[model samples]
Target: MADSLRRIDSGEASDDYLRGGGTGAVWRPPPAKRGALLQEALVRRPGSCIRRLAQGDRARQMQFSRFLHNGAVTVTEMAETAAARTAVVVAGRDVLAIQDSSELVFGGKEARARGFGPIGRGGNLGGLLLHSVLAVDAVTGALFGLVDVKVHNRRGGKVAARRARSTADKESQRWLDGMFSASRVLHEAARITVVADRESDIYEEFARRPANVHLLTRIAQDRRIEAAVDGSTMLFAFSDRLPEQARFVVTIPAAPGRRERAAELALRYSTVAVRKPKNGAAPDLPNSIVLTLVDVTETSVPEQGEPIHWRLITTHTVDSPAKARMMLDFYRRRWIIEDYFRTLKTAGFDIEAAEIQDPDAMVRLVAAVAVTGVTVLQLVRARDGTTDQLLRDAFDPADQPLLETISATLEGKTQRQKNPHPKGTLAYAAWVIARLGAWDGYYGKPGPKVMRIGLQEFHSIKYGFQLGLRDV
Candidate 1:
């Protein structure tokens, strides 16, 4: 590692990207050398292990592993830096702190690894649960970055036993941890709406949010209402009685055993006092709190299956139909993080499939690669008429020229097959790489998976390109 980085000082350095440049201004790792090595190792290869990134050099791979094990470089510091960078991205926009958790499955010689917890089907697998919060501009709907990520292991116990514990002590804490972290880091944003699914519907989470930070989560708790609008009715019953105010159409993505389809949904909303739950009570929560409840149900039943239904609770005022619709839109963006997890686990980074046995190293690798995962998503998402900003906004200065040189070479049969977005824009670069990764060189846009494979290939090209320059 020292030998490679030393080239930088002697004008022998090909470039920082080649030198491993994932370490950015947000992090402040001690003995800056570790920071440099990490950047080089991560950037040189999007998701490859130390051995692969180090060109199959076993000793070098051990050095890379040792660097992660060093006490000087802490995971909190790395995560904090990532949060700081995300804060900068969330500066002025009304953003959605989209949070969700996914379980990572790993295998080894033993089912129960020392550092890992029971995982997978029947708890026979070993792995970690990654709960992450990604920031998205609420108004413009642009991807910012990941503001918070909480990785933890589930302890061996009956599901009922785990649920009986305190919310703060259980896995549910990840929701609060994500919300508070976003509020603290992106505090300057116009408004931060913490968005998540039903799993995030915790009473403690609602009671704990800071001012200017609202939560938009699907309601799971059916707490009794103190003052029903018509009678002593529960949440769903009260919501059911409200007249449908608006009708809209929503597109549902394809899932296992389900085909992608569009459905016409009827929106029902009501202003109600959300009563406290009888079970797992929190001291700070009032007996009942005023909140806007919005329900979007597929009034039109689909041909084959259940229609889409989302019961949402929010602190944001949703008195008007437009506001209600906008809130639903915000909730919909929660899927962006879900797509992000796919990118991490599938083609791009494959952090879940990582074979590293050491828990700390695995954490370090995931944390470092997560930054790139965010960037890859940004590149792909920005193609949807979001920004005309140049590729320099996302790619390194050194990578631009190489990308440009290859862009024309990767073009399709006609001009339409080539990238039409502004030159140097992130979308243009994405187009070129997508072409390199076997996208139909024409106008059919590439998805996250295609973009990731392009990036992985681009890194190899860039790595060899930089090494070749060293000969000069």
Candidate 2:
């Protein structure tokens, strides 16, 4: 199948090769066969269409199906495929690969399966954890692709759980696994920075990550360490170097959900290089340089006079007090991933609702959803390039009647009057695609929703922009 698609893409085979014929086989070429084939191939079982395309004299399609059905394509093969796709998308870009985990709830009281771990209760359903690595363009926020995904399972024995570890103690190990897998796809880039929350502060994570991959994570309160200068081990403490003039004020915007407003106080500067005690059992652990910024805001002063503080730590060099302040600005971008997850779950890909029974199948399905979301995000970023107008021109083309229909439907007085959300080129494009996918029913009649739209539609709209590049 890949060879035939390659031949077609290379113009080596005539359209006849794709036409219907004899031999009890029917080949119906869709209007957008290239896009369709590529999209389907992205998610289809390995070698499913290889023989049907007749690119290989040996290895028939049936044989390939048998291979996949027999589980001949190992998990390593799937991981490789994901790595390749990620490399293709992120090549030559400055990106921050963000790693996090979420839960997918599965209902019913069936026996827990291996590789399935209980996360938390969700209404009447039970949740299973899914750990994912998402590579995002640092400046543009475009999703490059997924670095890797693992289903967190607790049913597996302790050894198996250790093998598929999810605890902070194991994050660095997982980071190593993802880095190697991504390196296979990305080869060596100039730099690859990894950003995560406080849970990522495992000693091994900082010790083992490739030097080229800079690590930035929040610091947990329970983390114990010592100042590296004197080799003195003690509990981590807040920097006492806060400016004497620093004043804490209750600001509503800075501290949301505070009943009587919240204080936003900034300390002047402080740096602490983390060092573990040599006498400890884990003496191999190396010291990690961390610049700390403690922001104490009074969300609600308890009757006991206790104050709340948000502590942030970073590996970034802070030459001056001003430089340290920028660390907060940099950390704000981490919230972008939260927005992304919300958009992904609410827009169409309700990953938590997936019903795939097997762990492998669930992994594949979640990856597929992430792929689709990334493809759309690419379009959004491309069209909304600095000159926001580019998106309006691209989606509201005057020459294309189909696009015109989409515009007209969106511009209808009823839609304008009834819909409160402001519509723009990006929104219009999303709405059009969603509507075409029968996202919310074009005219109130039931139609395909964003989730129901197959990969073909996503490919057609995306490739239609000439943004897609063929893998050589």
Candidate 3:
């Protein structure tokens, strides 16, 4: 075996990381130079990861599949790369590990996609499930990287039919598992705030917080609340009695199924002592836990539009209006992971469409592509450039020249064409990318479609530039 293929510790760094480092973790060293080649092949052709392999000669394509199914390149090691990238990004920053689960449905009807558990209380398709813990800067609201990912097949046959299973044995336990894994990995961050959707409103999870770890989650259960000034109350009842703290505006980004809208929302929050489950399902739960509840209700919107109503629970001290708004923003950042999942599916990487049939190989394939998906989404969201992050943070040195060329071509003539955002800012790279994606370069701001298209085009340009350089 080559020196590069040495089986170092699980948490080692990759060799080709000088390019501002994507999610390139040194999952155990490969048996040969295969590790480096695998990363490069994925980086070069991510949108159609499996297709890229097929496009090659027959012998080589088999090599690709063989590599994916290799004994050494397990999903656990691939996740190590995501963890490594995340640790670097959130080293000293106050960040949120936005946690969520997404399922990939491979075949249409009952194909029984290998190695996948039952999803959605028993649904149509079969495929693997992933729960991701992605780290994002809380202050700038920028996505740093994925801190951790847990991939498993659901077991919902007669196994799920067994009614005696504890909640710990259920799938929802993935939420708690994701939180603990993320917290343990990102404990060094200045602040590790776990943000989740309403599904994570687990009382036991709230009670299990580690030091310096906080949670800002939407309240799923309208559980019981301790007494107010006069009498006992339930969750929403406690929320209804609170005085309005303030009102604010938030930008709701567009998704595949939803349109973008700005919402003027009303805010009301109060502290509550949450009583334990009276039924006593959870024996380990505390008798009562005190937490701040923040309600952000839509003040006004067109009747045809969906109204915004968010009942959030947080460990943060929400005494002042400013603090309350801060927590809401943290909760909203949860969308970052949602966008990553979008990239993993049809919106971008399209990993589910891979032609591989082997279950283990598909899992390994999805793991690598998951990191690539994050890289693409990161470029799309790295607009603020508040951190003045270098273009090198995302673009390679060789690729920068091509990016500058496109940037110059896009910024034709007038001041509008000239992106005023300084170099090294994400906005600067984003402007160039949006233009490459075929934006008019005059639109106010590019939407996800434009960013997604532009990223694909930019990857092509990078590939071409590399080929040209190699030909020299």
Candidate 4:
């Protein structure tokens, strides 16, 4: 067993390592390179290992490299691809999915070349937009992975002279194309449900999505739908069947490029049925479910607000009032994606400031970064009690010394000082892990305001210690 461990740790393992050499024989090697062996073991462990493993996927790397060199692919396509892959690997089929887009503004100069629209009044301080998909474990509220990312154009009003006659740039089409492609990928994985805001209710988006995949999307005030019982045409509106305590509020993040605030609402039971348009082809939609529309407004700081009334359309079935309420609860999970985007840009990956010139390279890099974030979260969640036996089981026995070093460092820190924020308490270990994963975000004095201790950081610290163990 020791010999096989040595061979694997040294990158010298061969097919013969698995072959039986002798009966009741236990191959052992002299104790040496213990630190190096431990470091290798730490790298091999799952849950924060994606960042390193990403360097080894030749096919994915090659595809990204080609796209980067060509400058033809858009960030949205890459994000969509990453989201689709994540959905398959992490969320599978039984999860309720939330998808949304947020704007980030790079500088006007960066936007000019990237074809991003100009910053509207009060938008992010010159940043690009990012749209992302978040999957929450239905029972645990744990973040699974990012399904997609869309970087909006910063120069929306500018038009190049050569393409002045065109309606839109080819880059814009990539968002739609990527969405279509991601939908296919989701369909291939499992029977899953999707929830989105009204922006996703466009004809192409709904029409192109796979039939089996369920969607719950907010409706525009101008959207037309018919009453299932009355057969009368009208704009979709929330039914008056909500609980008296329903409320709504908006949220605005202090991050750059997000000048606008988002609305969050809490509503009660309402009926929704498809109303076919008078002149257009009827949408191929399944049975509709009535739901209470809750619009949580965007705000920089949490505050109180009035509940705004709205309506939504969904493909899910809400046969009972309780089921209808549950659907609304599911929709609230959409905020998880927003939190994820903030974490990626401000805390974990910092995708916006990345200098990779090739769009493909940017995509590959973002994918790797996003996956690394998820991996860190997974590792932090896996730790049990003070020992973290799960990590020990996955790591090679030779890597113990490095792990002990990390444990000692953490042991010295006060529990109150680990995660000062109330929301980040569950993710205190994430901060340490991020350090192990090679995250450099918290290097400066006192860390940034947006920098909360998180799982990614924990993964980094833990992995770094493991690497040290392997080298010892």
Candidate 5:
């Protein structure tokens, strides 16, 4: 492992994507020296603190700390690198860019010291607000990676009313910003579909959507429709009146207070012209925009559970039952972003536990974790072989040989102990890493924590392997 650091320090292993120059206030990628350090820090244990990432080397720990606190290492540069990597995988493929926001609460005193803003409903909490977009293969549901990320805290004290504020001055603007960000990053993709939850159902989100990019979001408000079509009926009531087209069963994942249960959902679809509100923020948008609504309602509800219902609004063509199902599947991909937040928070990185009090350093840490969190998700997504991702998705081309050797050494003579997935696939690499993390392959699937540990071990071994080659 020491040998790898030496190589990086000498600029022998600097990332090609990070080599560039910048002018003005824009944060360009660091020079080869810092670029090498940045790459090493990112590939370290995902979600680990600086001390752990430094592996008890006191000098390395200080260097890691300096890297985070450095003024040149900005979130903008980190996001650029993430986008460049995502563009490679999504090229020529239809992709879904899932956008969502999450709050990281660090307490009232911590907030005041760290310069964080209020985050809860009552405005009593102090934390940072993170909105990000994760790209996925539309057809296969394979994880592509993060396309864009925005991290900012609200103003210390807010005194503006909803009607008084423009979309640029409001937090809700992140939804529109995410769309623009994804479009810029995914220009290489054959098709781009942006998916979000109800909070993203803004007039501008639908109006300002980039050409060739589709939008899908759950209905948030009981918005009014154009009166010419059906006597000024509202969206919800109009949806309820639509005839059911099909019924399907789905297993709903368990949440904080909600138990997992099988839901029988009746699907309905219709085209409606959504009328712009009298006080709509964006006056430049058309008075009405035609959109397809796919309504899903639970036919049978469990005794202790609320009935599942989702009125999905989309720009996708949903004239047929098959197309409606496809939209639902795309909307379902929104959960991937939610899972990513969990991985960054309590599940994998435990980012909230970091003791960095400086606001800038904390922001940089979040940016680094934002990229690392996706790596953990990639491993979890690949563990089941459902995602047809290649080893290159999560690892470098040079690392493939090391993974192959590790897989062979970990396998036993018994077929049950062998890696079942095909070689050069992310699933096969995941199996090898799981075994390295002490997982019994037959027990169950390897989760984010297992993948995190396995990744740490792999990096350590990879460095030692590089050292041996240099010695030879």
Candidate 6:
């Protein structure tokens, strides 16, 4: 199936079946076949628009247009495909299902006509809200893939109060929904830890966690909890009273107006019984839920910027300092999803810039782009040999020969020109692709953009290789 698609993409075979008449009207194959082809095309070339993806081929571009607009192309099916791929790599491994949300804002006079709700500025702009679950190896922080994605548009209106609506009706439901989706997708994993930000701190989310899954979230609300010393007290106040366990230094990355510096942070953690909110109580839920709260606060004042403070709540055991540090490490994986969003948006794919206009089609395209972004990330991580991953982790077993062929051709007589990583490792493949993208082997590592371009060229070569096999 993939070979046939590759032949068509390489222009070695005619796309007559993809066109209706001599004039080149759009025609599609069976729904399943068409979907498969569309998925292949998107993965072959990651770009902002269908025209560029089609590379000026009228038939291919029209085919993508039809596929996106087709009612059968549902987000659920796309998400399931991504989940299945992730499940393969994450099986028997402790996985971190990091979840986060981002806004895709489209700016233009016709942006409002694109059928999306207002995003930025005074309910006047247009865009869609996206929430995604990125699966990562808990031990190595190596990205696996996206397990779930939910894209929605907010309706323009006078929004009701948060308490007025049931949890089902509120947009915050995405957090809980994303967690369950991750659990269902990664059921074979040894352990599944769902990590997220403060927005995911919900009573029902903690109360309804499955036996195999655990939740780790940055504390958002200062809810009432049963104090270790005595009666109920606010979460923040209770945490403030706990004695500091130890101090650790972490390098704070450079940000706007903040030079990178090592921050000495004091850590405190203890188990507490969190009282459920009285206002939005469900009938079957318990009055309180037990959770370990870990408070991480920077002890020293920095020359610039605010001090670091994080109150984290989790279901994982944090009795000892090592366990507490492990929980903190898990929370750090949230940055992986943030980096993914950056790749999907401004930094790499720039999906918002795509010319796709319809809301439904836009949602489907965003989901596809979300999946494609994983490939770039895998290569970026593999650019350095520390990941200890195999080529099969990112590329198919069949592509090994082509990767080897490309790697051999890229090597020069000099030692520096040769691939430094071991053969058959993902790093070796990355080195070959980086060379294809014009990156000097001796210079800095290949980033996402370099890897993305290299991947595009690799797929193009793969298509030609597939055509050559047909002749042989």
The candidate that achieves the highest TM-score relative to the unseen native structure: 5
TM-score for each predicted model, relative to the true structure: 0.87, 0.60, 0.86, 0.56, 0.91, 0.89
TM-score of 4: 0.56
Between prediction 2 and prediction 4, the one with superior TM-score is 2
Per model, state how many residue pairs clash. 4, 6, 2, 84, 1, 0
Evaluated against the true structure, the overall lDDT of model 1 is 0.71
Q: Write the per-residue lDDT of candidate 2 for residues 23-126, one digit (tens) a residue.
A: 11112234333422322432221111334222353534333233233322233333334444566545566667677666666554441543345455532334
- Displacement of residue 194 (Cα, Å) in model 6 is 0.3
lDDT of 6 by residue, 399-469 (tens): 77888899999999999989899988888988988888789888777777787778788889988987898
Stretches > 4 Å off in candidate 1 = 1-36, 156-165, 228-232, 387-393
RMSD of each: 5.1, 10.3, 4.1, 11.3, 5.3, 6.2
Supply candidate 4's per-residue lDDT for 238: 30
lDDT of 5 by residue, 45-88 (tens): 65557777666778767776776776756677667767767877
lDDT of 3 by residue, 279-381 (tens): 6247777888899999999987733457888899988888889999998888888887887888778777677777777767777777767765666676677
- Per-residue error for 81 in candidate 5, Å, reads 1.2
lDDT of 4 by residue, 357-451 (tens): 43334443443344334433333333222222223222223434444455346543555334222221223333444444444424532221112
Superior by lDDT: candidate 2 or candidate 6: 6
The local lDDT score (0 to 100) that residue 443 gets in candidate 5 is 87
lDDT of 3 at 64: 66
RMSD value for candidate 1 = 5.1
Q: Please list the C-alpha lDDT of all candidates, in the order they appear.
A: 0.71, 0.45, 0.71, 0.43, 0.78, 0.78
Residue-level lDDT of model 1, residues 203-256, one tens digit each, is 778877788789999988776665534645688877777899999888887765
